[model samples]
Target: MASNIDKYKSDLQKLLKLGQQLYYAMNYEVFEDKFIKNIRTVMNSDEEVTKFIKDLPDFDLKYQPWYSESLVLIKQLLPDRLGDFIKYYEKPKNRKLLESDNYTIEDYLQGNIRNQSFKIATSVGLDAALPQFRQQLSILQSIQARFESSLFDIRQLVQADFFDSELAAAKELLKHKFARAAGAVAGVVLEKHLFQVLCDHHIAIKKNPAINDLNEALKKNSVIDTPQWLFIQRLGAIRNLCSHNKINEPTPEEVGDLIAGVDKTIKTIF
Candidate 1:
């Protein structure tokens, strides 16, 4: 009687030979639909097997001869079940192997099918989802970096005794930093609001000049502007003070108020 490993090997071989035939020989369109459906079903039904397959390295089986050999052996063992499928395995090397004894039909068949099924499924899903995932990730990362830098600027302002500085110098630095932070926040919020407006009302703005445009658009769309705009402006100024090493900065309390205001704005907008 075949051992569990042998049975698995046999099943794998049959599937691999079929996938190779479908993918290489017949072109991807021939059995892609059926192959994908069956693989998904098997993955869902067998958690352990799915895990094992997912854990395998992503390169050719030459790196793990035993695993590769087992797959090939499996494929040859199920010729009747996979003969039609082998039409897909039209690659020169694969075709050669199918006709050679370099690897057992059983092992080669099993490994190839299991690996190919996993490869195809993952490739298709990732290809479809990666762009959206990356976009969201980039947005979150930018938000995190902005918040961190804001906190750092606030700390430096307190240490520099900005509150005790001359009024003119302090005000100038304050304005600069405020603009910077406002711009960052505006960039995030405007994009979001504009997209929403376009989707809901079929209204679109081809170009955004500044945060003012976003504010006006929001007002036009019946969305209330958040007080956070003021805070973002303040944060931008604080950022400038630190960047330029300006003398006489705003008080910690004043900066705190700005940050709080911006946070409030974010809460309202989001």
Candidate 2:
């Protein structure tokens, strides 16, 4: 699966590629009717956006009213990046720039207005009427960095929730007097949670991590103390004993200890 960063990069790259193409087409004076259609496809929106806005108040207005909503897919797939892109995109545009001679509908109707339009787009958007390329790039970079950190936090939260559910299921098993079952469940949860924490921190571990391997890995990474590591290893042994009847099954008290240890580790460190 592709990461969110990859998708965000793709979206930004697509926009830049389109912008460059448009620039070149205007610069070179491409075909007459086709470039008009190309510009329409690129700039003019045929899609309606206002339907997403619910419960708009009904009122009479003397002046023209404008309303807009962005494409839903853009925000959903590239939520963090696109959201911040939209937010601060026009901040520098609020500043004034030296006014250029205004073009009318007549200017657009005349041939060879592509250069004029391209010049305007390059300097400043028509609506905003100001140009700040450096500031725009800086803001965009800051937004991307923040989006990355926010994605990391979201991963942590999702892992935490999954661990919470697994731990609770193990306790419920124990409540039903399924001591052996509870020990195995708690042990599995412990291993999975530890692996998730490692992933959250971008730590690489061996594939199909074992409990003892995880315990040592956690300690080596300063994720747990030596005593806690040893305790976790013992819990792994309890899980092994519970799994095999050749060794005596773990008692309820032993299983309770397993659950308690897992719970404590989750609460304190996770």
Candidate 3:
């Protein structure tokens, strides 16, 4: 399984290539046929867009023009483009004559409207009605540049030193086949980090919190959504089982899930 960072980098590159293709093709079909088909898979979802932007390295650098421009486009422009294209135009190529209507008397009579429509249409289709293809490509290009610089900011893919002690220790424990202990440590890390999330977001917290308490606080404070909150609630059970009952040993598989879940959860909140 690739880490989230690796997946983010991979998807960013793919979106970049798709943008270049759309730009050169200069046709609505590029968007209708290829770009739309893949963008959702590439970015996962709108929620993940916020995650990707947040996760990018050097996110605060002042000099990356593409990075900042892309941020604005992603948040503001690409969304409307994604929503309505051919459908917004509300007409299909098949409906129109294969050729222009023989330069009809009616067309000559209404020459100004005809001329504008001609500008809107190209050798392709009624692309004049919309230029979402261009908009999509523009945003993809911004995302590409941002990711490129950010990757450099973070250095290599395996930046284990970037992690805090508990997280790093849990990884080392897993490497040494200490699955049960790793599971416990991961639980502690999850709670501590969720606590940190509260502090970072300025959410009110009670003294000496449990996982349930932390998870609920996160949800109530709008730090995490319902689905994520629910998933971590299950992680809370695994943590409790591992920490509270010495005799009820967690399986390696369960511990592995615990580790992965906590890792992703923390990254998302951050």
Candidate 4:
């Protein structure tokens, strides 16, 4: 009896010959219809073909190109049945190819599999990182809320002092100066906190880095140097003005600039 491999090879050759005849001889309509109908009758009579047909993935029953169609039919006939066929006919001939030796087949397969696995892992890692980013954003928002609350309270206190005996007894000329001094001090504190929070979030400079060390690090990670950083710096300056009581009312332009800076920094980091 012929081995399974020999049988498969013979069938494949027959299939190829039929295809060539159809392509070159232009007798495909006649040959394919009659030959395929006869083959189907034979296949239906054979237990092996019955088994093969049962293993195929769902496909239109009327589709032709018999060799490819037969392979799918065989697969559907027996689930995971190809593994046995592969082991018998497709095992690597070179043992060195099975071993991970330099440019061997094993090494190539390993590299391909590793790359596929890494793509899956990277996708999962990005999904996991999103929640952490949201948490960091929430913390920054909380800091902003606290800062605003503190500034409002300071403003109220400064306003109350206008009616205080100390301010009332003072010359009218020094009253404006006193209010400005209070605002300036509040603005400085607010700026300091903004800087501290950014550093805490790892979105700004390291707190204790020496100037030289910082410069060297920046050189290495120069891509991190961004317009967002400049925006944050400008926002801090505006916060400083408010905290220090230099201006009783900050301009809308200053507030908008500060908001834009914070937004840019958040977007870049996350």
lDDT of 1 by residue, 1-270 (tens): 344334444545454443333222221123545545566665656675455345444323322343234333323232232332232222235532222222222332334322243234221221222232233223323323433464423332231222222222433444666533333333343334334433444555557434455545555665444454444445445534433434755454554444444334432342
Candidate 2 per-residue lDDT over residues 62-141, each given as its tens digit: 00121011222233333445544444322224333323233221222132133333345333223221122222233334
Q: What is the C-alpha lDDT of each candidate?
A: 0.37, 0.53, 0.57, 0.36
lDDT of 4 by residue, 92-205 (tens): 554322211212212322232222332342211212222322332232233234334644233322322322322223223123444333334333333333343344335556
Q: How far off is model 4, as Cα RMSD?
A: 27.2
Ranked by lDDT, top first = 3, 2, 1, 4
Count of residue pairs whose backbone atoms collide, per candidate: 45, 0, 1, 23
Off by over 4 Å in 4: 1-223
Model 3 misplaced regions, further than 4 Å: 1-11, 22-130, 143-177, 196-202, 267-270
RMSD of each: 23.4, 16.8, 15.3, 27.2
TM-score of each: 0.22, 0.42, 0.49, 0.22
Higher-scoring candidate on lDDT, 1 or 4: 1
Model 3 per-residue lDDT at 67 = 31
Ranking by TM-score: 3, 2, 4, 1
Q: What is the lDDT for 17 in model 2?
A: 42
Backbone clash tally for model 3?
1
